[model samples]
Target: MQRKFACFGGSFDPPHFGHLRIIESVLNAKEIDKLFLVPNFLNPFKSHFYFSPKLRLEWLRILCKESLKVWADKIEILDYEVRQNAPIPTYQTLQFIQQTYSLTPKDKMYLLVGADNVESLHKWQNFDWLQNNVEFVIIPRKGFRIPQNFQTLPFCAMDISSTQIRNKLACSDFVELSRLIPQPILELILKEINCKKIDKK
Candidate 1:
């Protein structure tokens, strides 16, 4: 049987419930054999991050562990981006997967993104190559307007954002953070916060 792979790349500085729901929704809806949750070392579009790439990878691993409760063997946290010293574009990452895995012609691949990304899809590096070479699973973001004719998958519409979580963390507001963030992931974030405090001292 041919295997179908989907790549879900993001700067999951601290993976939260919304992100998990999106991944689960994709797994439940798609005919995918494996779903890779790749954490980028540097997001080309975004400039600042609260946690380092290494810490982010650690958080993703914690998320994968928690995700196993739902889909036992489907979720994988890939570190291809974190291993890179420089920023690598999404298209290049996909190319590396194709070459590294020696994917057969019969094997299928797809890219997953939220509606906000779809709105700015034209601004991405090598947009034409990305569009022509890979299929996409556009996920719906709470506020962003999705374009017509795009195949959007159902993700839980939570009014949560990574930025909001980061703000709560910075303010030491664990109550709100706990509501939006997963327990294991929150534990990892607390460790990162302590490390930052130690670095400052």
Candidate 2:
């Protein structure tokens, strides 16, 4: 029997509540049977990563175990691009997935993307191949409009992003940060980064 699979790729710089929301959303979704977390070595659009690929992948697995209570069957942390140690394009990533899983044209891989990526999606390397090979599952953002052509996942507007979390780290407090990030991940961040935090009273 053919199984359904979805891929949610991102930096996951510091997996936060927003990421948790999406993770839960996709896994709980009836349309998907399993999910693959493809953490990038580095996003082609970006120059650097605050955390190394190894750490990010480790944290993601910790997130799944501690917070999501997920196992290998439910979720997989793929290091295809990270192993290559280069900013590989999404197109290549999808091709790798397609070939890896023996997916055919009829078995279209469900590709998850944020609303922010919608506008520039057409500009992504080999966008034509993506359009034909996968179904776009749009995770809504505050300002962006999801095109009718794309499928949308239900998400309440939360003005949180990985970029926002990084910026807040230096100048902002963990009290707020604690709420944005998952408790398990937050604890690791506090320990690894040597930051302070307060238990909510």
Q: Candidate 1: where is the Cα deviation over 4 Å? A: none
lDDT (Cα, tens digit) per residue for candidate 2, span 138-201: 9999999999988998777589988888877877578889878887787777676663334332
lDDT of 1 by residue, 1-201 (tens): 687999999998778988888887888899888888899998998777668888888887877776656675777777898898667799989888888877777888889988888868888899998877778878887778877777778776678888898889889999999998888788877986798799999
Error of 1 at 57 (Å): 0.5
- CA lDDT, every model vs. true structure: 0.83, 0.83
lDDT of 2 at 157: 58
Cα distance off (Å), candidate 2, residue 125: 0.5
Clashing pairs in 2: none
RMSD of each: 1.6, 4.5
